[model samples]
Target: MAKRSNGEGSVRRRPNGTWEARLYYEDPRTGVRKRRSFYGQTAAEARRQMREARERLAAGAPVADSVMTMQEWCWRWLETTVAASSRRPATRVLYESLVRSHLSLPPLGQMMLGRVRPSDIEALVLRLRARGLAESTVQRIFIVLRMALEGAVRDGLIARNPAALVRPPRIERTEARHLSVEEVSALLECARGTRYYSLLRLIATTGLRKGEALALTWDAVDLDRGELQVRATLTRIEGELVVSAPKTAQSRRVLPLAPAEVEMLAAHREQQAVELSRVGEWQQDGFVFTTETGEPMDPRNVLRAMTTAAANAGLSDVNVHTLRHSAATAWLEAGVNVKAVSALLGHADIRITADVYGHVSEAVSRAAMVGLSDSLREPPRD
Candidate 1:
C-alpha cells in the first residue's frame, strides 16, 4: 500500500471485519515515527474519528494515553478536584452519589476518555429518561458529568468535553405550592400545643427556608428589637446533621420580625426555660428551635410534624416549604417592595424573587388591572 500524506490517515478493514484508521506522526521528544489507531464498525466512521484526532493533534491538544478509561479519569477528577472544592457537605455528597452511581455505569464508563463522543452522552441521557428519572434529575446528572469532564479537559486528559456539546434535558417550570392565608391559619391551629408550633409560625411569617429556620440560634434572635439574623443553615449529610453557612453570602442577612412573632418567641423562650429547669442539665445548643433536651431540631422530625399538621388542617400536598411560599405570596400581594421581599427570602438576587413570586399574586394582578381599566373609563355620575 502507498504511504498516505501527513494530514491524511489510512483506513483499512481488519480480519474480524471491523474498520480501523491509522495516523502516523513523529514523537515530539524522540523524533521517531509513531502511529495511533481509531476503530469503528465502518470505514467512514473510523476515518472520521481519525480525522478528528489529527485535527486535535494539529491544534496542539495533547492526546492522553488510551489506557485511561472514563471511569478512571472521572474518579481521579472527583477525588482530586470536586472533593477538594469548597461546596457544602450536602452538595458534595450529592455530587459523589452522581459520579459513583450514575456516571460510572456500564459501557460509557469503560470507554476511553478521549473516545467518548457526543452521541454517547446523548444516549446516556436517553437511557436515564427511559429509566423514569425526572428531566430535572437527568439535567443535574449532566451538570455533574460536564463539570467533571471540564476538569478532565483542564487536566489535559482529554482534548475537549464531549458532554459540553450534548444538550441537557429540558424541565417544565411548575408553580411552587403555597398555602393561602386561611390555610396557613388552619395549619398553625393544628400545630398548636406541639413543639413545632412556634417554628411553624416563625417560618410562615419570616419566609425563612426550612434549613435556615432550623439553624437559628438564640444569640442571632433579638426579641426586644424584633430582629432575626440568618447566619447559617442545617443540612443532613451522609445521615448526619451538618450546620453550614447560608446558601450564599446574601443569605446571611438580618430580617425584621413582626410584633406578634416577637411575643411568640418570648413566650417560647420562657417555656424553654421551664423545660430546661425540669431536665436539670440541658444540652444548651442555643438553637431557637430545639427538642425538649435543648438540642437542635432534626429537620426530618420537623418535616414529619409539618406533614401531619398539614393533613390535620385539611390541606393537600402541603409541606414545610409551603410556609415560605405562602409568606412570599402574601407579601407580594400586599404591595411589599420586591427588593425587600428578595432580601427577606434570602434570595441572591431580586430577579429570583420576581420570577418565583411575581405572577403568583393573581388577586393582586387582577386588582391592578381593574383599577387601571376603571381609571381609563368615565366616572360614575354623582
Candidate 2:
C-alpha cells in the first residue's frame, strides 16, 4: 500500500490510539531539514497543532526539534556561556569543577535536554543528600544545573526550564562561635612575637577576612590617617594563589584602624624594613604582611600559626576566622549600631550582619532584657 504524502504534514494513528501529525521543515539556523511531531487525542486536533507548527516554522520561528542531550548542552553552556562570561576567575573555576565532577554522570547527564523534568532534578538532589553531601554543596550543584538550563531556554532548545520548577535543599545555618574579651586577650598574648601576631590582632580588631588581610598592600593603607582600604582578596585557584576583587562591590571598603593597631603596624613596618635591608634588596611588593624573606606568606601558614597560638592559650576550637566573629560580637555587645558593624565588616547587607550576630550575642540580649525590666519597675510613692 502506498502511503499518503501531504505537502505540509502527515497524519497517522499512533499505537496507543492517539493521533500524531509530523511537519517537515528546514531549520533557519542550520539550513537542515527537520521534523516536528504534534500529538493529540484526535486527528483533527493533531492536524490543528501541525498547522500552527507549520505556520510558525514558515515564519522563521523555531520549532521544538532539538535532539541535544543534557551532557551536550551542559558542555556547550560551560564552554561558550560560562567560560565566556564576565564571572570572576574563581567563580568560573568553581562552576566548571562542579559541572565536571558532579553533574556529568549516568542516568541524568545522558538524558535528553528537553526531557529533563522537575522529578529528575529532585531525584538528583535526594541522591546527593543520601550520599551525605552538605546542603550547601547540594544547593551549589542545583544552581549550576539551573544556570545551564537557563542557557538552553535562551537558545530555544527547551520551552521551559525544569530546574526553575524544583526547589533546592535549604542550607542549615550554624552559629559562629566568638571569643570572650579575656580569651581574646589571652590569645593575643600567646601570639605575641609570632609572625601571625599582628595578622591575628588585625583580624580581631577590624574583622578583615583572612584572605583580604593577606592580599593587602602598603599602598592601600594610610597609617597616618589610621585607615585600611579593602580592594582585593587573595584566593587559591587550582593550587595557585590569585588576587582578585572582592566578592561584591560592597566588599570594597575603607576601615578605620584603632590607635593601638596603627602603632603595631608602624612597628611591623620598621621591622620589615630592617629585615629587607639585611637581605640586601627590598621586596618590590610592599605588602604589610609577609615572611622574613619579604614574600607574601601563605594563608595556610598563617592559619597554622594561629592554631598553635590558640592551643597555647588554652582556647579550644578557635581558628583564624574566629577573630573576625569575635570582633563583630564584641562590637554588638558594646552597643555599636548593627549597620555600623555591617559596614565595618564589609557586609553587602545589614540584614546579613543582623542574621549572623544579632541573636548570637547572648550578653547583649541579656542586657537588653535587664534594661527593659528596669524601665518597667514602678516607683515607690513617697
Candidate 3:
C-alpha cells in the first residue's frame, strides 16, 4: 500500500519557542478536505515529525490528529508505535496493560488531545494515589502516559506532552527480598516431587533469572567444565511462548557452577530421559527443562510450582526472584567481591548489584569486622 501523495507541508516557528508543521489532505473515504498539524521544539524536529506521519500513511496507518480524543490517540499510538517497536515483549505488555487499566479511564479518555492540559494529568496522578494504588504502580501509570504522549509528539499528533509538565508521584525505595538458608532448604524439600524442583534448586543456588532458566537448552550447559551460559530468555507474548536473545549483552554470560549442581543436573538429564521415553509424542526440543512430552516449560507453570512450594514450607511472599536474591546474598556474605558477584549474576552494571544487595546481612557484617581486625593486626617483630 502506498501513501496517497500529501500536499507539501509548511513549517513555522511559533512565538512561544515551539515549532509547527502543517499539511492538508483529502479524506479518501469521505472526500472531505482536512488539515493535519505536527509540532516540535525545533524546525528540524517538526519536519521530522511530519515525515514520520507521511511514512505511517504510506504504511496504511492513519495518523490521528490533535482533534482526536485521548482514548483514540492512545489506541493508535499503541498499535502504530509501542506494539510495532523493537522493544522487549515484556515492555510492550506493560505499556498496553497500563493504557487499558488507567489511561482509558474517564478523566482523560474522552478529552481531545488539543485540549489536554498539565492539570488534567495531575488530576490523574492524584486520582491514582487516592485510590490506594501502590506508589510503584502510580509511578508506572504516569510514566506510560508520558511515553504515550511522547509518541504523540513524534507522530505529529500533539504539540507537546502535558504529562511531562505534571509532576509524577515519587516512587518509594525497595530492596529485593531474599530467603534464609533454612527457608531455602525447606522450600526445596517441599518442592522435591514437583515439576519445578530442579529448576527452583538451580535458581536458588545459581541466581539465574526465571526467564533465563526456562529458556536453557542442553547445548548451553557444560557439565564437565562446571559452567553454563545464559544465551536466551523465554517470554510469553499474547499467550504464545517465544524464545529471544538476552535483554542485554551482559546477560549473555558464562557462569561457573558448583559440583553439587552439576551432579544434580546430570541426574536430572537421566530422569528426563526416562520421563520422555514414556511419552510417545516427545518433541525432542533439546531444552534442559521441559514438559512431560518434551515441550518447552511455561513460566506460569514455574510460578505455580513456586507458589505451592512456598505455601507448603510456610514461606510468605516467596517467588523465583526471592531465590535469586538469596543466592546473591549468600555469595556476598561469603566475602565474594561485589564486582565478581555482579558478573556472576550478569548484572548490566555493578551499581545495580550494589544497590539491590547493598543491605548488610549478619554474616557480611561479621566478615567485615573480622577483615578489619586482621588488617589492623600488630606487627609480630614489635
Q: How accurate is candidate 1 locally (lDDT)?
A: 0.87
- The worst-scoring run of ten residues by lDDT in candidate 1 lies at 58-67
RMSD (CA, Å), each prediction: 4.9, 4.2, 8.5
Error of 3 at 273 (Å): 1.5
RMSD of candidate 1 to the truth, in angstroms, is 4.9
Estimate, for each residue in 1-382, the C-alpha lDDT of model 3 and write its tens digit.
Answer: 5554565578889999899999766654466767788999999998998888766555544545468888888988889888778888877788888889889878698899878899999888889889999999999888888988888777666656788888778974567899889899999999998789999999999999999999999999999999999999998988999888888899999988899999999999999999987888897778998998888899998999999999999999888889999999888877799999999899999999998998878776888899899999999994
What are the models' TM-scores?
Answer: 0.85, 0.88, 0.79
Model 1, span 270-313: residue lDDT tens:
99999999996798679889998988889999999999999999
lDDT of each: 0.87, 0.86, 0.86
1-382: candidate 2 lDDT, tens digit per residue? 5543323578999999999998877676787767778899999999999887766565544576357888888888988998887788899999878888778886788898878899999999998899998899999999999999988877767767899999767886666788998999999999998888998999999999999999999999999999999999987888887888999888999999989999999999998888988886555787889888777778889989988889999998999899999999989889898999999999988888887785545666788899999999999889
Top candidate when judged by TM-score against the true structure: 2
Error of 2 at 327 (Å): 0.7
